[model samples]
Target: MVPRRRGRRPWHRSRAYRLARTAVLVTVLVTVVRCGHDMPHGGAARAGHAAAARPVPPPRPLPRSPATTLRVPSVDVDAPVVGVRLDSAHQLRTPPLDKPQLVGWYQDGPTPGETGTAIAVGHRDSRTGPAVFAALAQVPRGSRIEAGRADGRTAVYTVDRVRVFDRDDFPDKEVYGPSRRPELRILTCGGLYNRRTGYTSNVVVFAHLTATR
Candidate 1:
């Protein structure tokens, strides 16, 4: 009777609905992003760079020379270093419990200034009293570590990080892995001390060569 409406005036195609949809479409926004690793080409790249944003190169590594002493000023540690090897149980031996003033260096690895990882181990305490690295865990990042070598040169390193690990689950690869740049690892007993079991964890200081004298 109403002039036979065409499919009841299809709601989707009505003028009111079409105007609302067009308004929504106009309000929508789209953004596209692309990431790249390659540097920009030509002089345009140089013009956009600021002096402060320029990256500085790392220091060059020094020649091999056994470490003779170790110093950590932040914790007031200055101890003579002596060569130490793995014990019968295949563990890197610590300095003699009796000579708490001494630091033990892992002789199998590169010297402090050399282009590889070097290690120094000391006791955190002994039955007598506090030992060489007693406050090693307190050392903060950016602290200076100096290693006196046999060549009468000092290999200066800046502390990067300090961490404590349970002795049973120590990470061998991450802690002692091969490194192309000069590196030093300082270790001492840490965590809880048990009357029967001694220390439950190990404190390690990671550092890298930064200067020499």
Candidate 2:
């Protein structure tokens, strides 16, 4: 009667164990495929995205130029410029009365298109009559000025203001001060005429560089 008992199967050969093994094999295969995709090409794609997201740098600025000619359309001032040195009084030398049509540029200071105040002085009038810059005061605000440079380029400017300061209170620092960008100082005799003291005031035109050609 101890009879008929059936033997149990091993765990490795059971139907549930076989299904688990199949599931594990499928999961391992899927993981291997996912890892392969994420390794080489995915890394390259991230690098490409990073490079595309980078910003481009700006271009460099042009070099400075020396002024040769000056033109102001508003006042009809189109004149050739000549370089002159400082006088014994440590002042900018004036153009000869005989050549009142010429404009004098301060040679020791910044050039026309350089990064500082460029001083240009002219005779407002001569003993005979009107001079080159005689009508400079008539130039309105927001006028345009063009200065030809030695580098075969023209520097364009816009007149910001025109001022007449008495010789006793001339703002030398403002007119000839150091600047971060190219500036222009157009100067001439102005205000009341004094037989003993000459011109009682100085006319100054302030202009800033706006364009270059």
Candidate 3:
């Protein structure tokens, strides 16, 4: 990750995202979320990460801009982004399964670099094989996540924690809550895979803005 510049520009203060993130983001595939047994999946990936990170100084938020790309170096995920909306069922929709390499941004929420929790979701793996976020659970704390904005600026976030939650007990607030500072959440299906119920957990990566360029 590149070091943040010392001399910073003036930042804009904005409100937290007010829309309730009520949509259950349970799968990349609308019907079922699946993952192969080859790698660390689900509960096994929930190693405590709170102790692994260094304290980060707060960073000012940038003006709202649609994310164009998302890059997670540790996970080897580099993909173009598309806006995802909630379906009539109020379920969060994902990118096309055929485009396994693409990531979906919650278009109804805050844009990356804004003063709120922005969200991005991707498939852990698709039929084509390991997809964009296939290794998301393995991303270590303190690593950087870059969200490229349409404005040609980039918002750099430092991973604070990585956790896997049982889908039945997913925390709606903690994972999708509004924030005073610019924050981000990267999510994917995780935990154990069950034939009848699909993946049992949701892998969530919590990160906060540390720099912009």
Candidate 4:
């Protein structure tokens, strides 16, 4: 008989090869488990992706009406309130100063005499001196705010409270929320003035409609 040549067994019948393959398979499974936490369908990964994909709702609309005039008898603020358009830049337009006191309405928001929070902004001081709203900080709760509209209607509001806020932390919701009773928000710069940072805070007066005159 011819001498048989030595040769390797087929993989399915090799004990050493089977052990090596099992080792490699275990290593690969371990690596996948270690990194699976960060995979897109993993628990933490799914939460992160959902949060990033969520949409933010748009801001609510302001009330609407004809142009109106605002008057605060306690602070001696009487001016023709002109509508400040809501521009793409999202800025509150400054009213023209025919006199020292002119209140500008944020056109994007609720109009005076409407059942919602209406914003009226004015300059705290002019180049000459303290302008309209110079005494805004002194306005107390229970004070009256009046708005006279060109459509032959008048709305009266009572001061509810006043607050100061850093521009960075402006309470946009509370200051601009909808109301069953007409509301008013008076905004102006107050607090310490920083040469580099501009005004440190904003003075806001909150008032609720008391009556229509």
Q: Kindly list the per-residue Cα lDDT of model 4 for residues 65-167, writing each as its tens digit.
A: 6547888888788888777653333234455543446777766555666766666777666556777777888887798888887767777778889887764
TM-score of every candidate relative to the true structure: 0.73, 0.68, 0.74, 0.65
lDDT for model 3: 0.68
Q: Estimate the overall C-alpha local distance difference test score of candidate 4.
A: 0.56
Choose the strongest candidate by lDDT. 3
RMSD of each: 27.3, 40.1, 14.6, 30.7
Counting clashing residue pairs in each candidate, in order, gives: 0, 0, 1, 4
Comparing 1 with 4 on TM-score, the higher-scoring candidate is: 1
Question: Candidate 4 has which clashing residue pairs, if any?
Answer: 62-109, 62-110, 63-110, 63-111
Task: Look at candidate 1 and tell me the lDDT of residue 201.
Answer: 66
In the range 1-213, model 2's lDDT, one tens digit per residue, is 001112422111111111111121122111100000000223333543663343433222236565688898998889988887644433335567667788877666666666666677777776567888888888888988988878898877788999887655555456555666777888776666544334555678998877767
Per-residue C-alpha lDDT of model 1 across residues 60-172, encoded as one tens digit per residue: 78777787999999999989999876544334555665688898887766787887767787766655778888899999999999999999999999999999877566665
- Answer with 3 or 4, whichever has the higher TM-score: 3
lDDT of 3 by residue, 113-181 (tens): 888778887776765588788789999999999999999999999999999876555666787756778
